[model samples]
Target: MNILTEILLQAERTPNAAAIVQFGRGSGCSFDEEILCSYRTLVEQAQGLCTRILRRVAADAQVGVVMGNSAEWVLADLALMLAGCTQVPVPLAFSAPQAGWLLQNCAVVLTDASGAMRLQEWLETGLDLPRNTMHVVFGHYQQQSAAAPTSRAALSGPDRIVKVVHTSGTTFRPKGVRIRRDGLDALVSALWQRASKDDYRRYLSLVPFSLLIEQVTAIYLPLTSGGALLLPPADMLPLGSPGVIAADRLEIIRAARASALTLTPALVEALAAQAIRLAGRADALHALFGRPTAPLLAAGGAPVANQTLTTLDQLGIPVYQGYGLSENSSVATWNHRGANRIGTVGQPLPHVEVRVADDGELCLRSTSLFAGYSNDDPSSCIVDDDGWLHTGDLATRDSEGFVTITGRKKTLIITANGRNVSPEWLESAYRSVPGVLHVIVYGDDRQFLGGIFVVADRSRADEIRLAIADYARRHLSEIEHIHTPLLIEHSPDVMAQLFTVTGRPRRDAIAPFLSLQKDPSVHEHP
Candidate 1:
């Protein structure tokens, strides 16, 4: 069955139940809270939008979606599926040039109210978008209403192209992944089968709905399971918000009474911190204020550290971590309640087969694997001729079948002496140090590992430095010991370079700083 069928099924089952809650710029709207939209209303909106989109573009045409996290974004995505266009979700944090690149690459473009404004600004500034390609703004496109006809009908199966999700542009040019309806169906079905039998009636989403992972789990999964999806207000969890703060997210999670939440590791850290704070005040706070409980919390995108897991456990929140890439429909392996391991991403979900190569590169075969990269590149981004998705993550699986991701294939740091080191492992170890806000390890062609450290609170630098030294002495080997940590007064300008939108470090962008520190002139002068 197609993923869109889930929405139609949910509408049939519970037409009056809440479909989506969109947190907007000033405030927000909820289907159940403010404006009551029966599932039928949502289905109709999708159908109307689909009719309008297909009128302008062909079936199997790639349609770019440029919008922030909102109900409009979700509706546009569903509409694209209904219309038989491949939906390409561009990162909202992308620069104007990046946005233009995506638009040029895709066959047509679709934007919500805010994205149209942003795109218009870029267009006025001379970003050359394709002429034949039309732009369908989600709400109230004034000047171009006469350009296209709008209708309300679903497309035939042969017309559908489910999605074309772009990879995070960290090291290479972003590639658009083409997914078919069957691939999406397999992923959602696998997830549903594994989900708790108890009703997952309410969900709170923090990530942008444009992200395929969020699209599948937060929007589609909830709808398929007959659940309510709540989005946080735009201002509270803005794209520009610092990646580390948990207070804003905790507010939404509590307010929505979200039984399930999907988060990146950065958000997971914040959640863990919030959970610890709650656990710390559990006794006194229980008497003064009633404690709120959320049973299921799942985190992915990046690895969650051991410390964070322990903290979540202490807070009585069941936090599970999963592992996947955009090529695999966002999840291949996940840790669930009964089969969870502390440091592993857990076993592969049913019907997904994971294997580690001799050199430890993780590989998989799954029904959710993409059809191919957009533009039909023969040099596959993931799938080989044999159909295995070569996930570039280096991992280890235990006897019990738990998978632990050690590092990325591109992220492996080779020492000048030929020793292979995983920088991520070292970074995770360094973060365990008190007052270390961020750490990036570098030793690409050097004899020893060195790092650029961002101290959490500058005033406590001396104490932290000493504590870190002591911890390293006790825990790490002489080679594993940090050669020297250069302390920065402030966090690196990651956002300025678009290395990270959230608090997670962009290791590749920061690698150049390592070269600067390693320059021989400084030591020669000394």
Candidate 2:
């Protein structure tokens, strides 16, 4: 069944019940305006927008949705699904060149007025668009009173491709992952089943809707459960940089009294910084995160430091770490209320089958796996003949079935002595330092490990370096210890090029930018 059908059913059951809550932005500690959209009102808005869009484009044409996250973004998503058009969610992180490549064959591109203006600026900057493609602003479409009827015939098909999601990585370009209706449905169903009963009342969206995990948890899960999808006001925090969620933005969660949140590792780090400031006091934690009310705080995207998780746990915040990729449809394994594992990324979900390959790479088989890459890229051939998707992530599964991700297949650092070390563990250790923004370990062919750090305060570089070195001494092996440290100030421009859209450091691309300083230890080795 089409996922839009789930929303339609919910609208029929509780037409007047609040389906979405939009918080208004203000400079004060507490928000001022709260706009609630009933199920019926949401459906009407989606239907009207869908009707307007269908009139403009051909059947099954690709429609690019580019906008800042908001209620309108959610409405546009539902509208596109109800109309049976393929949606390409363009995240703000994508450069004009990347977005152009993804939307090459699209018939129309939909965006807010501000997004449209940005597109125009890109065009002036020499971004080439398909001659037939038209750029349209969503605000031009008006909501109608009568709901536009969904044509079931247009949506039903054996080959179900609903959305083309783009994956973020260190690759030269972004890969478009084709996600089917059945896959998304299965993922949402499994997540809803694993969700905490106490915290399932509302799902808060802190990330962009363009992200597939945010799309599933923030949009589909809430719609299917007949709960509210809470969105922060656009003006609450400025958007532009990747992985830079404002510390004050957490106030939206407290103001909304939201229960569930899908947090990126960077956001978890931000919360960790706040917790440190509050000294893990119960009252302060309650004031910042709505402790007793917030239950399902799942962290993913990157490896959240164990220290950060410990801090959040001490503050009475429930932080569940999960592991997945775009190929596995967002989440393959997760820690839920029933099975809470701290360091490991819990057990596989009911619909997922996971195994450790001979080489220690994680392999997965699930109904939610993507059909294929949009360009038929051979790299998508990670799936072997037997059907297990060979996830490049190296992992280990315990007797209890909990999977601990060790590192990535491509990111394994081989030292000159032929000893292979996972940079992830070492990087996580450095990230645990309070002022460290990002750290990239570089010692692929060197005698010892070295790294460059993007710290919040470069003036305290010595202090940060000592803290990391002390942590390494206690937690990491001698080979994994960082022998050389290059500290750079935390600026958006510097981070934009050094880090991927998902906040992972671009190690291969970063070495050229750093000035190498010979360590006394490295000279002794040679």
Candidate 3:
């Protein structure tokens, strides 16, 4: 059955149950916003959107979703599915040039309140589009007299492409991964099954819905399971807020009484710090959620440091790390909440097969894998003959089937002495040092390994450096020790360089900086 049916089924079972809670921005709405329509509201809204979209575009044509994390974003996604149109989620952080590339690639586009203003600005500036391309704003434009392009009679089956999500574009040019309905169904079902096992009740979403994984877990999974989604408060800062204190996130958890939350490594670190600041008075926070003192914290989007995990664990949070790329449709392998290993991403989820190549690269096969990349040849990303999605991440599996990600194969550093070092390992170790916010390890084609460290707490920089040095000396061999930690005062221009959202360092994009920093005159230390 189609994935959209899951929403329909949930609405039928518990129409009054809270479906979505959108926080931040100006408006806040609960599941009861349209009480009478209930679950039918989702179907009706999507149907309205679908009817409007299909009137101007082919059934299989791509429609871009450019918005932040909000209810409008979720509605647009469901509407696209019901309309049988391929949805493309454009990051709200995308620049005009980047947005233009996606717009040119897709046949049609949709923008929500958050993104509509910017898209209009770009469009009014005379952004060129294909002759037949169309762009529509979600709430702004309701009626059009244009002739219908294709009727529902010509619509393809559900197995056709449903959505397209672009990669973070850190290393290479951004590429779109095309997701099909069947794949989404499998993913949503697997997530619901897992949530059922864990008794996942309330979901609090902070990740932008533009992400495919966020779409599945934060939106679809909750709806499928007949659970509630608690959103952040309207005054809460965005994920990258300069003043985003732990209290900000704590308020959301308390307000939503959220039992489940998914966040990036950075947010995890921040939340851990907040927990510490609470000084063990977590009862108010815990009580607000109607959950035990411990909450299930699932972290993805980046590799979390062991120290951060250990800290959160000590603070009564169950931390689970998982690994997935846009190509695999969000999560191929995840650490179950109760069945977690300290440094591993846990085991492969149900119906997913994960194996390590002879070279230690992780390979996966799953029903949730994307159909292919858009605009380019499908084979360029997915080699259909192998039936395995090649995850560039290198990993090692234990006898118990737990997977520990070592590093990205493409980012592995080969020292001048021919020893292979996983920069991720070094960076993970560095984050254990207090006051260090971000660390990038580099020694490629160099005599020794070194790193660029960005410290959030500048006052403790000296102390952190000394502590890191002591830790490295105690735990690492001479080769693994960084000769010196270069402290960066300013954040890297990631967006300008097209590295990542949330300002995470892109190893590939920083390679040039690494090369320039390496001094050939320095001799290797034996």
Candidate 4:
């Protein structure tokens, strides 16, 4: 909670320690990596930017930030919190139109030089924008980092809207999760102490920092423990931005010598496969991570198959599965180092209370709960009168408190014959084929399942189709099999936009493709 305050305190405790590292910066350190900012430098630079920000933005003004991963990006985030501006981050993964839609309400934007060019390009295209928006480029004052502290801007009030996390839901229009200072403070504290289990020393940040979960695990947790934040060089920062093709992500992670990192089910599954393949070699773990020692890997953002976990367990890789959403700020339940279960996301964080509804929807209430969605009526919000945010996710709680997310309460693919299926597992099974990058299965109220596969190599279409058939036959019940499987090829960015941070497909965004399921002429993929 109070990320900026807590980080500043850590800076006071360890002034000269490396706080952030940017790989391939080529600042004459390690040929490609540099301790881009020390704790003191990070604080001072942020404080300097804070002074610049308040001159243009009033207290609690929603300010949008658009940038790739860098020390500058983190600095801008801290500066906004320090300045009491309601920070809204626009993920670079979004197209110009989507980014503009998210930033429509904000009058001021903070950006890096690269971000400035991006915003300017978007503006030139005449995106419907807030009138007369102001832009302040941060990371320009890198020269002043070593200077003594200046007049400090005030911290945001505990009850004030300190940040707004913009999430693109089913609609092209995004929803902003309004976060209060106190709520953030509670979430971060509990997460660092309990969920992280303090095993993280170097957090390899792969996802966008714009993501709330990444903000917690990548920024706050590391800063709380006085650990370093490892950032990928832009070429390697591949998750959110579809434009960026990930270049040997495992190698980048290995090179970082990362101690702790979070992975989507897709990434972890691939990692587990790689680890299992190299198990016979002495450098097997080295090939997967960096050293012979395995890192603390957290798999979330989707339901990882039990097979993936089983493989990692056999390979001696330490993985803790967990679940959360932007509504809970980030993580509400996590399996700590000692208390991990194979199939379940661990118990709720100490601050969170969990309950399963009569219909099996998992609900939770916590101090970390979002204040409400920005500009939305409190009464119309997801959290009901009892303070429970009914997470839409269907789940079951074991006697021991472990929680298993079964499927979406609203997304059960009901067949004409009356059988029900959760498409997550079915999608996971299909996505396991090497060429299939992503899969989304849909057939609600229909007789069979239909799927869209994002393939890595379109030339291998026939081979991948055979592989898909092989996997579907083996892993799926007959009803769970994808009856109409469509193989399509697109840039990774186009494909990335189809899913949420947690790996669930944004159904509305993919509605056009799903419409094919209704066509009577389309038969099963042979």
Candidate 5:
């Protein structure tokens, strides 16, 4: 079942209902200045765009999208799906060379005016593009005399590849994940089944459209449920800074009256800090959101600290964290409203089976499993003979079925005494310390664990170090305690090298930068 069918159905049944709302460029808090598209108009425009794209590309040919999250990007994605063309989405944050590398495998690339200009600049810098690759700017999509195809069945089968999402692999390089129509349909079904029955009137899109999680929850989930997708202006929520993103996101959620939101852990942490500042004033918090409260906030992409979750709960905004990967078509386990466990990423969704292997790896079998990697066969990379996708995450499932992720399989630290440790638990615990911004643990072959901490202020380094030392003494065993805490300078370059796009610490990428710290101290304070 093609997902576009749902959009068409909504158009036929409820033509006047809002399908998409594009917020205008302003202070990021203006709902009066907006462009609203009805269901009928959305379908007509998508069909019109589909008519133009079919003339340029063959069936099942790859179509690349090098644009940010906006109404134009949404239309292009739907047009490709309806036209039976596989979409290759490129995030705006990717470098010109990285964008070109993704475009090399595609038959056509679609972008807005700015994206086309960026590509032209890259070409002038001697970046090569495949000779057969076609470039189609969004505004130039002319309505041809030929009739547009309404359904995808005429061009491609449901089980065939429909989209290729590019994500960071274990090697820290970009890799393409292929997803099919049936897999996407299964994912939508699982999500709808897992979520509460309350109808979400407006859903906010916070992350980049290139991300698979955003593509599903932000776009597909809302579409299937007949909810309006509220997209902020391109300049309002830039991905450059976490602080800016959190501020803009809060403003838009209030202005748009969004009933649902999916966010990254970094964004959640930033918002938690803001919520703490607004704690005592109920009226001010109500005025900030415009309503008395906001909607359900679902977080993912990284481990959300217990402090962050508790702070959000105190603000009257519930947060449910989930665990998923690009290989599983976005979500495998989620803590929905019904069965939300505080610390664990909730039970497996419908039709998804999860188990822990003997070696502490999480294996998943789901109907929504990705087809395969773009350059490698499924069997070679993750999928095993029994059809389980071996997620490289170390996790444990409780008797009640909640899954707690410990760390990555490739990031386990082994001491000389042969004790293995996962740093994520310790990092999360350290985050509970006030003023602690980031922590990375390292002790591969050493006698004791040591770490680098990025704090809010250099003067408070001693305070944070002593707090962590006391925390380790109370909670951790002797073998797991981190004896040395090294304070480091926080800079943009340091963050870029140490963190992934979703704000998860990349242990291997951060290992080389750890040498910048000159001294490590064991706190004498209790």
Candidate 6:
């Protein structure tokens, strides 16, 4: 299937409807939902850009994309798919070393104005690609071309790698996950089957486009569902270093009136908190989402607390929890509107097959399974001979097919926005502090990183906290900054309770000690 062409066909059918809207960027009201592009504009711009790109980049050639969430980001995403180039998306949250690691594998890199500057800075480190390799693509949408646009590029086959999805997870070094067109198509199609056209009248994208899942939900899902994707305000990108949650997210939701959207568990909690404050209001749903009825909300990335899901449901927010991975091409199991099971990651999606292994590990077989890793070791491979991807997490399937993820077999903490965090890498940074003895970096399902530290010297606890703060500000990436830490004198009982016999931190044991209801941003750390 030609995904780009199909989307353009949708635009032609719904020519009068909104294809994309930028809130507060319009001319009229504060949240006027400035028509960034109508379906006609999308066909004109995307097709025109596709024609332009096909002439320069060869089909299946690795091309890198670096930018924040914006209209141009949308164009680059769609146009590259139309041109049949293998897109390599780079997150803005990535450090220079991480970005350089990815760029080394790409022949060409695309960037907006801000990304261009960062790419140029890499030259000083002698780690970036050549000057000509970087293409600044910030304002391509401003000049809509009237020239004849190519409808679609010649896609060779289903097995051909159409995209190289990158993940900065589990390892400090970056790695690419190969995605085939067939898998991508099948995954989206299966999800589209579960959605109605009107579900996402406006789907506000809250996460970075670098996330493959976001690209699927924010771009493809909206296209297939006949929904308009409401891009977040350019400066209001959440999951930025220092602050995982956008500073004014509640305010943005109050204004956008987005009909449906995906959120991390943390953001769900934040919205639930706000919804409680505005409880019983006549226009609460209207203020949060443009509709008076309950808006379709899907939560994933990390495990969403059942209590949190129940809270949103009581307030008319139908929060459907799901489980997914970049390997499975966004969503493997999802709880849709009609069928939802609390405390579980929902039933397996229509396209995916799930089974619990003899060892209780959740294994998945799907057309959407990632092709392969670009550089990681063969020994670290998750896929077995018969095609089932052995996910490191342990799980169980109920009689009704609801799968609950019990625990992980590996030491990886996936953040709420779906970013994978290697606590070991984080702990290494904390342990660098002289007074810091044992450092436990824990933020699974939690948006911002927080820590529990054991101090070498009891009197130096305050001093160690200050030093750790300095290290976080000067050394660590913004997103990796620990929100707060519990520095205490070491005790055998405390250590025993924090980690299981296998040495993994006991999340439940540590939960009561951590602060909730507030996660201070990077600025608030010091």
- Top candidate by TM-score: 6
Tens-place lDDT digits, model 4, residues 1-526:
5667678888989999899987884543232667887898887777777777666767668888887676777888777777777888876545566677778778687776566776776777677655444444434554244432332334442377777886534333456788877888889888766644345678898876777788878888888778899987765554523222233466677778888988765467567767878888988888777777888888676676787787788778868888887788878899877888999999999899999999998999999888877645222237789899988888999999999988875654543222335565557767778899888877543334578788877888788878887765544434455645777775756566677777678776666655555544244321
RMSD of 3: 11.9
Task: Write one digit per residue (lDDT tens) for candidate 1, span 1-526.
Answer: 5566667777888888887765443345222234335576776776767766666777667778877676777777777766667777766545455566666757777776566665676677575865443454434322122222332234233434577776533322345677677777888888876786243566777666656777887778777766777766655543222232443455555446566767656556666665566565645223211235554777776566697787677666667888876688778999887887889888998879988989998999988887776544322456678778787779999998899988876765544322334565567778899888677776654435567777767778678778777866555433445635666545456334423666566766765654566433112110
Every candidate's lDDT: 0.64, 0.71, 0.64, 0.71, 0.70, 0.73
Better of 2 and 6 by TM-score: 6
lDDT: worst 10-residue window of model 1:
143-152
Can you tell me which runs of candidate 1 are displaced by over 4 Å?
23-36, 105-107, 130-160, 169-172, 197-199, 238-246, 280-292, 375-382, 412-526
- Model 5 lDDT per residue over 394-428, tens place: 99999989999888766656442223356765677
Model 3, stretches more than 4 Å misplaced?
A: 24-37, 124-126, 129-158, 169-172, 197-200, 233-237, 240-248, 279-292, 375-384, 412-526
Reference-based lDDT, residue 290, model 1: 24
Error of 4 at 460 (Å): 23
Question: At residue 178, what lDDT does model 5 achieve?
Answer: 88
* Candidate 6 lDDT over residue span 1-526, tens digit each: 4566567678768877788888764454355557777777775666666666666666667788887777777887777776678888877666667776676767677778666766766566555564445454533543234543334334334467878877655555666888878888889888877777677678888877888888888888787656799976666655534554543576667667777788876677777887788789998887766568766788887887778788778888878888888788878888887788789888888879999999999999998999888878322438999999998889999998999999888767777656677777678777888788777887776666668887867788667778988876555556777756767678887678676667666766766655432433211231
Best by lDDT: 6
Off by over 4 Å in 5: 26-31, 130-158, 170-173, 196-199, 240-245, 377-381, 411-526
TM-scores, all candidates, are 0.71, 0.75, 0.70, 0.75, 0.75, 0.87
Q: How large an RMSD does model 4 have?
A: 10.7
Model 6, residue 162: displacement in angstroms? Answer: 1.9
Which 10-residue window of candidate 2 scores lowest in summed lDDT?
A: 237-246
Alpha-carbon RMSD of each model? 11.7, 10.8, 11.9, 10.7, 11.2, 3.9
In model 4, the clashing pairs are 1-184, 1-185, 24-32, 242-493, 301-502
